[model samples]
Target: MREHRGFEALGQAVALAEPPLIESSARTDVGVHRRVNEDAVFADGGVYVVADGMGGHEAGDLASAAAIEPFRALAAAHGARDYRMVEATIELARRAVDTVSLRTERGAGCTLTGVVLIEHGGIPHWYVMNVGDSRVYLHSGAELTQLTVDHSLHAELLAEGRAEAADTPRNVITRALGSGDSRHDAWLLPVHAGGASWCALTG
Candidate 1:
């Protein structure tokens, strides 16, 4: 809600920095298909996030914004150096998203993924978060590595070693904000001196 609204066939670029050390860039494109771009992105010092709202329902836009609201506050406060803070913030975010769904008769939901810069043992680190199928990637020079596991039906099937079910589609998310599931996954990593890229997609 604090940034630009997604527009059809539009692409947005953002430059984020951690001061004298890190420089990052992010973009979001609505492409040519959807009439309403229900995705939203937030990029600033030490925080980057993407929320892919469940399409077809107008409330998905609200759900995605609701999901990132708390994180936006966290980022404004420089995110969390303590892992416990992240947990508390996530709870707040879940409640906020739930409120959005409760207000809509058809319900609403979204996938969220992002990274926060934190300090651990006097060293800076990246605190990564993921819910639903939205992904977060770490880029170094020419190499890219996925850092978050998606909370989706296909991922669940693969985790259960059901090779036969691996063919399941990616859209069936197992967990998401406003889906009545308050759980998510996260990772804490040391910030690379060479500067790495973190991208979370929604549109």
Candidate 2:
């Protein structure tokens, strides 16, 4: 299996009297059965992103790479703080993936999930965005809480009591980039100094 790893830490300490240090780590592996890894990640400049390409589709890797390129570029420019910029970046990613879909003619698509550190009233906060089934989790003390909902058929089925979570196919995502649906969910929450968060792109 092909494995890729990345790590990032924000050195620009939060301007608080006692600044909070931020650190992160990410790893992705291509399954034993897969020939290539179809996941891409960007973790830098107080921004983190994970894009999981649709399996069983042509050019999955390319789709995922395209989906993350915009965010990666933005990270180089100090990342985004306004919600509008974040939304615009995602839209650009959607178009990038769509270009792959059109060129490959194999329904290329990917799930995008990410978080950006922002400031509100001089206090730090996390702005989360999600599309498809990729997830974000916040760990506080000994408890782990999911911060994003899955946009997948299995999740919908379980929510409606039409199917059991164990019986549903987890890979059936209901929304994704390049699917002509650019809509995504967003949330803003205070970032506690001692708390930690991470993003996961599950198949």
Candidate 3:
């Protein structure tokens, strides 16, 4: 509730006059690595998403392409201006991932992440989602804060102080799209206007 309120207030303030903007970019080399990125004009207004294909494996590219296709269709079908439409679109993508078959190539899977911008009474707000280690960062003013938590064992260890530095570690992501696991839920966040804000959904 507190988080919701915080985002709501922030969105309202930004919509009034700040005209906050959101931008994102990413790269993917399927199976080897994949990235997801997004940007929004408001919490519920405009939205953009990018999915990078993991290289090194044939399946990686397929997975990335499959994962991103749904989001693109959703955005085109419902438009990014509607909050419910965006949420529904995510659900659609999740289902689409579940239906895909995994490839034999090692570490072959895909990452998914996105953001939506919404405006109410001229106020701008943002909604974000992520799955896998692909990340989302917020650049507000001079401060850059990570907005999404990674779904990896390494990230878990870091959170518990069991891992040091940002170096790679054991227990990396064990599952991903087409890894036989169905149902990858998106981690959602709301962005409000005030300082300049952007998203980085990296795999």
Candidate 4:
């Protein structure tokens, strides 16, 4: 809850709130060894997405892009849809990814990570999602915390203490869009006004 600051002696100090202005940006790079970049980044109208294609998949690029297509469409036209809208959008994206796999017939798939802006009771909120190894982070004050867990063998091994994740070559994802597990981990979070987001790429 926001604290009411200052004295409200002047007729209760009535003030109107302005609608949040949505903003976003994105960037991606073809990794060192891949001939084709299998990662997709999308940011628009307060919707942000990053997807990585499954390694060795022939149509990974298409899968990654397809995973974000539904949200891309929603960015241009949306209202205060709440979580219902978010669930529908993700289903759309999953279907798009499935189409890509069927058209290619290559078992194509990709990891999905994203944050969508929505309104709840006239207040802005964020709908966050993740699948496979892609992740989302929340930065508050001096702490940056991971908000999603990886749906990968490496993560599972680490979680179960079966094996150390020091070398990930032995690891493979257990979930992805259009392949393996198709479930999306989702969260509804309050959007702190005046907060910002950015893209940070490592290798």
Q: Which one is best on TM-score?
A: 2
Candidate 3 residue 26 C-alpha distance from true site, Å = 6.9
lDDT of 1 by residue, 22-73 (tens): 5667666666977666787888767778888887444887887787788777
Cα error of candidate 3 at position 87, Å: 2.8
Which consecutive 10 residues in model 4 have the weakest lDDT in total? 1-10
Give Cα-based local distance difference scores for all models. 0.71, 0.76, 0.51, 0.72
Question: What are the candidates' C-alpha RMSDs?
Answer: 8.8, 7.4, 6.6, 8.7
How well does candidate 2 match the true structure in TM-score terms?
Answer: 0.84
lDDT of 3 by residue, 95-192 (tens): 55445433353544566655666544444455666566666577767888876666677787677887462675533663355444423333334444
Clash statistics: count for each candidate: 0, 0, 21, 0
- TM-scores of the models, in the given order? 0.82, 0.84, 0.62, 0.81
Candidate with best lDDT: 2
| Candidate 1 global TM-score | 0.82
Candidate 2 C-alpha error for residue 55, in Å? 0.9
